[model samples]
Target: MLINIMGFLVSYVFCLIITPLISKLALKLNAVDIPDHRKVHVKPMPRLGGLGVYLAFIIGLIVIGFPIMSNIQVILGATLIVILGILDDIYILKPYQKLIIQFVAALVVVYGHVSVDFLYLPFIGTVDLSVSIIPITVLWIIGITNSINLIDGLDGLASGISFIIVFVFVILAIINQQDTILMLSFVLLGSILGFLYHNFFPARIFLGDSGSLFLGFMVSVISLMGLYKTVTVSSLFLPVIILGLPLMDTFLAIFRRLKKHQSVMAPDKEHLHHQLIKFGLSHRKAVLLMYMLSATFGIVAIIFSKAILWGTLLFSLLVIFISHYFYNYNFNKIIHFLNRKYNKT
Candidate 1:
């Protein structure tokens, strides 16, 4: 355990020390996200921040001496995402093209047998979802990828969320006594923290599509392994509630798009960060608040996992209610009022 932790830390420091240099190179290459009316930031910031994270992650894994797997599906899936994202960063691929790439990556994970095979329903017994697990797992992977991608609008947003999730996964893995996942989480956590050095506030570089998709895929795969690796799904709620921020963001985005009759993949400025900014929060403050929200859910998940079913149920509802109260900052009301006034003509 200690050795695994050490390997992760060594790679983490390696990543941290090199992150600024990566940002500098990104800037020099003009791989920056330029400002637009819909964008929160007002400057040109270099992107493809995922490259450093991916490089550091792979280096950490190799250093940890687990490069080869029985099937190597996770490695291949993540690599595909990185390549697809890198290409999109350079050439700005069409939405369809990007979706196709994402689907392909999910397919690798699904067919590679790294998917969630069943839901270990608490008390209700094991729910065999094998026959339909493929489609469900694909959607889960693809949805999570896009969720993280869209949530990357704010500096430090996606990185911070990834940090929160991986941290929780590490803890869960330890409790479950899943040595492989526990070690994997350490390396992942370390690598992500290394990226945060450059990805944090007053960001030097954006993660672009590559980093977000890579992160989303990793979180999905790792969580599945943590909870579904065995014959039971006794603690699936932990990951779901723990990932409240991204899941809620994804849920809201889909509903908002559907309501507007827009394509689910339609780009917009109505993300969680954008709403917070509209409510007069600074970028730093908004991101920090989100971090706090993420931390709260993470901590609650840990506590909930140790509680009884009824107790966990109550705790989950309380978290949701609190989230609802705080998240409703009335941005939609403002938009509606403005639309009404303008449409009076």
Candidate 2:
């Protein structure tokens, strides 16, 4: 417990100290985000904030003497992802190019025995995924990687969501006796919390692709380590519940793009955050509302871990319905929708 606290504090303080330097370095490298039609910020901001988080995580691990050699594959894959993000932030890599690099990084993580090996369905017993595990794992990694990246539209939004996830995982880890996930999650939590200091509204810096992708990759890989026990279908939904915000946003984005015959990777301003802002919420309010939603998902995930199957399902449905309602309808209308639903029921 003390060791975990130390790791979190070290990572947090170091990230606080190092992020400003990273910001200056971002400026020097010409890796800044320029405002355009789809973006909310009006001026160019440093976009390499992920470097601070990455460096702090490594520092935390080293200071704690965590065995890096044992997780060499995860480190290598994360390094590759950070490099890809840096290149994209500076040079604006084509979508296909970014996809190829992400695929390679996903493969690296999956190779480290982090892949899902099987699934225990409702009626069928444990079903071995066999050859399908690799692709499934890779897809999960890439999907989550981009999900965090895509949700990085607002200041501190991605960082906050990631923190909620790691915090939930930390509790789950304690419950499940997953020491690795607990330690890694604590370090991640600290780094992201530190980053949020400069990342919130009226931002000092943006997470850029580098930070968001690294966060997404870490979340996916770490969840795979502990959340896929598959004791029950509800247990299987733990990761999904914790990561509901980003995954839901990503799913909606993909669906909207497909419906419009647009490329799935194309940039757009119709994201949940954008929608909330369009519905008259202030920047901070919109972000805070999303934070509440994400935290609710985390709470449900914790309940799921407790094997409260029916209770978890009920809350999950409510959360999904509310989230979908907010995504498609005005914020003010949510009260009316809930009232009508209650009256109908």
Candidate 1 Cα errors over 4 Å, as ranges: 24-29, 230-234, 317-345
For candidate 2, the 10 contiguous residues with the lowest summed lDDT are 334-343
As a whole number from 0 to 100, the lDDT of residue 282 in candidate 1 is 66
- Cα lDDT over the full model 1: 0.80
Which residue pairs collide in model 2, if any?
Answer: none
- lDDT tens digits by residue: candidate 2, 218-266: 9999988888754666656778889998999999999999999999999
Expressed as tens digits, the lDDT of each residue in 131-185 for candidate 1 is 8888888887887778788888888999899889888888877887887787777
Q: Weakest 10 consecutive residues, lDDT, candidate 1?
A: 334-343
Q: Per-prediction TM-score, please?
A: 0.89, 0.92
Model 2 RMSD in Å is 4.1
Best by TM-score: 2
